[model samples]
Target: MGGNQTQTQFILLGITDSPRVQMPLFVLFLLIYIVTLVGNVGIITLVRVSPSLHTPMYFFLTHFAFVDICYSTVVSPRMLADLLSEDKTISFADCMMQSQSFTHFAVVECHLLAMMAYDRHVAICHPLLYVTIISSRVCWQLVASSYLFAFLSAIICTWCTFGGSFCGPNRIDHFFCDVVPVLRLMCSDTHSSEMVIFAFVTINVVGTSIIILLSYISIIRTMLRMCSAQKRAKAFHTCASHLTAVALLYGSAFFMYLQPPSSHRSLDKVASILYAVLNPMLNPFIYSLRNKEVKGALVKCRRRFFNHWQQRSVVSSRT
Candidate 1:
């Protein structure tokens, strides 16, 4: 219970300790991380460069893409390294840092999705007032609030988790220093921490989810009243990408964190991989494939990039 008995160095058991699967797992996660970076970064850049995407929806999307990149980077690279290396030890500071960063991104993303939903809600439900209501200044304020609140939330969570003493077995059961598994290692009482985490998670997850649900419900009702089928189709098309992103995020996140710490098992690592790794890698594809505007922007960007490369090649040949 005292500082003298506290252990600062913790060993992460990681996804597995199998020698045979190490290289394979390492290669697989490395690829996933690479794609996550490229995909999320591509979306962010595409939105920035494409003039057509200068709306409130794409504005929120750019921020969401950024968060996905950070969230994936927080765990995937470290998890990849641990998969290959025999030493999976992480210091107290590093583990807390990772958890805090991960939690911050996760919280930011949750509210961003809600704000995006509200953007869509205004766009569809109040078509005439959409521009005035969700103006550029308003969008910036929404994004700023999401990040600021999430930053504070992350500090509180990290404190709640690390405030307890870690004088017992220092081995973590997961690939990364997850809160539930890490809390299990604490020798001191974890009830308050777990309760605080539960409350934090409930407010963020459920509150944001409610916002999304209500926004969609309003959008749906507006869609139903549309006299023209084309208008209805267009509205659905607008929100589809965000809806897919929300589904993936909430489904995996709920599975990962909605339970008591005692209920956590090996399966939690799999859930972590789903949201933290796979979701980031999948979002770019989800948006680019489903949204015609994003697809058109991608095509335009590709053509410009290729044309520049071709001109440079011809210049080099002439020289």
Candidate 2:
């Protein structure tokens, strides 16, 4: 923004301008968006109804799922709609809203994954103190703090992103209003804004990643010291799923933010899709399919639902 001559709106160039690909891309991502919402929401519901899943691990997981849904929604809906509509124009106010909202949830996801790793670490490495350490009160405080940190970080990031002049180049190359893409459009110097946003991204990604790495190291040491073979296997199995999600999420996230803004729009867009779209959609499956406990909880919930429905049907027939 020129502070005075900022464009009122922007035209999003989207994934592709070709007519041949737009419909196909629209259908493809629409399905992904559906699965992201369903899978994340379903996980939240499963945790609530399943008593066995009410522990510190699932507590963090519930919030992670929520963040995934929210962050993905910040981009996917608008992107998908733009795929179909001839006009992909978005107002300056709307672009800033999208940018800030995405930042909020993205920070939330990073911390929640780190928190989940810590929860597992306590459960495995310090089993005797797990109950005392990761108590209900502590878990809630962690979740609350994650949101608070995200809120503050997003405000600063959004402010810095639009702090420069955008009097020219009213077209954003990507499908959505991401910080880097929008930064490239600025008519004014974007070095300060890019650095500020990069610092925030680094702190959230690398800082949280360090916590996860240390927790896993301690957990591995504890697992090795265990005398029983069965306990070690069980611990490894539990850690595997969390590691998968961490890789899927952080790999793209680091690729996107840890470096300077790229001139290659295609590479940037692909990285964005991985963390922003694919990560959220795949998390529920990754977390659930790998864990025996989540599977067992799902079975119990299904049975309970069927039983309740049967009871209602029997009473209606009697009447």
Candidate 3:
């Protein structure tokens, strides 16, 4: 199809269209979005202000929190809007932008998790080399590469999706614009497009998953050889949090994207909500509540903030 002949707008049916469900759904999602913002922002602030969190692990965590915030923001606002709106429509350009941004940050997070796993592997398996291996420059490079490659991958996936013609029914069943849901709306054959999506997803999902698996294998092997039970317990405790996050994120993502687009529309929508909305909101708690270091940092940060406020109050009273 020619450029001028392509689709201009699309109707998003969203999770549902029932008048009875709108307000309840709106309220629920609005609260979730608020929590997502506060949680992610809190993690970023904690990482920035706490000197104890200046290590490589927290360095990657800061970026992960950033990605979570960006990813949730991409989907949540529009989703919240659609829940309350009668029409629930989005422009082609806007839909494409959402897909691209969502995919970019999501992929960045996938590889970032793998990188974090590798960081743990080095820390436990080779503590002597951890500092030299995961230096400040290398941390920057890992984060930079994640964003760079994820952007390129996002472009490819977006192109493959939008390149097809959308002459069929313009109504999307899901809450937001996604490659598979959008592909289902296309009048053109989606064989090539679906194949491209599959290949990219495999690389992004399975490829990173393999890295994480291998890293953990090594970490486990090294931990087993440790002389002290305390060392092993501490190491496993650190790994547990990242593993939980990876399971929640990748489990929902794989369920949503791995299968054919035509399968389980409602189920897929719910799973999408899990990863896009709930996961990000829960991540800060997962990392902070489970990890002693983060908890300590939060306590320290809180004290400093409270003391600063107290000093400011006293100065204002004197003035």
Candidate 4:
């Protein structure tokens, strides 16, 4: 009777843990997960192998590609596995670790997107000063600072959430161990913890979002003043890609977090899908399709890859 009671108390959670949506959702996410990996990996490879693609813009873009890959990996695989399992239960320690890593990657991506915007601003508005303004040292510092802040935020949030109690029924309803879902599982009073999470989310989403808006405003104003139509058009095109990425990321994130708790859980799963899965998949296509340089590099990389393959075939045939 004691064992039966203990077994009954163990909570299982997530969308796929239900019978209604398991197979359909699993197939859908499997496709999305594959596309995300291929797209991000292709972008990274294209940027790395093409020498002409070396610039502050592509440098940051390469990192963005890597971050997208890491971000998706942090959540999607486990979520996919959970889809196939009968019991979608995560251990307390596993849940904490997932929350920490997911938060770290998500926060870093927020700042990194802002930094990319700043890069675009300098490149477009201060073409003469672009080299000096975005020097290697400055770029490295920006990347380093983004990672440092993300790590700090993740650590603080993890401490706040994980140190609390989970007395019973430890089920997280969403795919990954996000703050809201995990907090819902805790038995302890989580007012302070929720506040901390809210503050951090605000900084990453709202704070960086304001900065991005301001930068783009300045960029648009500067572009309007430019004498050359060609240059202005180029600047607008370059800025559009970054703008789209920023809009999608912050829009979904804010929608998820800014709402009252009553509305959070219902929207949590959908919001998590945007930044965690779709945003990463879109990042590569945004960069490649919008930026002439990235498109050119991709073309070059494809040609080279095929040429190398053909050469190997020819050599084997001759031998």
What's the TM-score of each model vs. the native?
Answer: 0.95, 0.96, 0.96, 0.91
In model 4, the Cα lDDT at residue 183 comes to 68
lDDT of each: 0.91, 0.91, 0.90, 0.81
The best-first sequence of candidates by TM-score reads 2, 3, 1, 4
The reply for model 3, stretches above 4 Å from the true place, is: 1-5, 310-319
List of clashing residue pairs for candidate 1: none
lDDT of 4 by residue, 231-259 (tens): 88988888888888988888888888776
| Candidate 3 residue lDDT tens string, 1-319 | 2253267888888888788998898999899889888998999998998999999999999999999999999999998888777878898988889999999999999999999999999999889999999999999999999999999999999988887777768888788888888888888788888989999999999999999999999998998899999999999999989999999999998998898877856788889989988999999999999999999999998899899999999999999
Minimum summed lDDT over a 10-residue window in model 2 is located at 1-10
* Per-residue error (Å), model 1, residue 318: 7.5
- Per-residue lDDT, model 3, residue 289, is 90
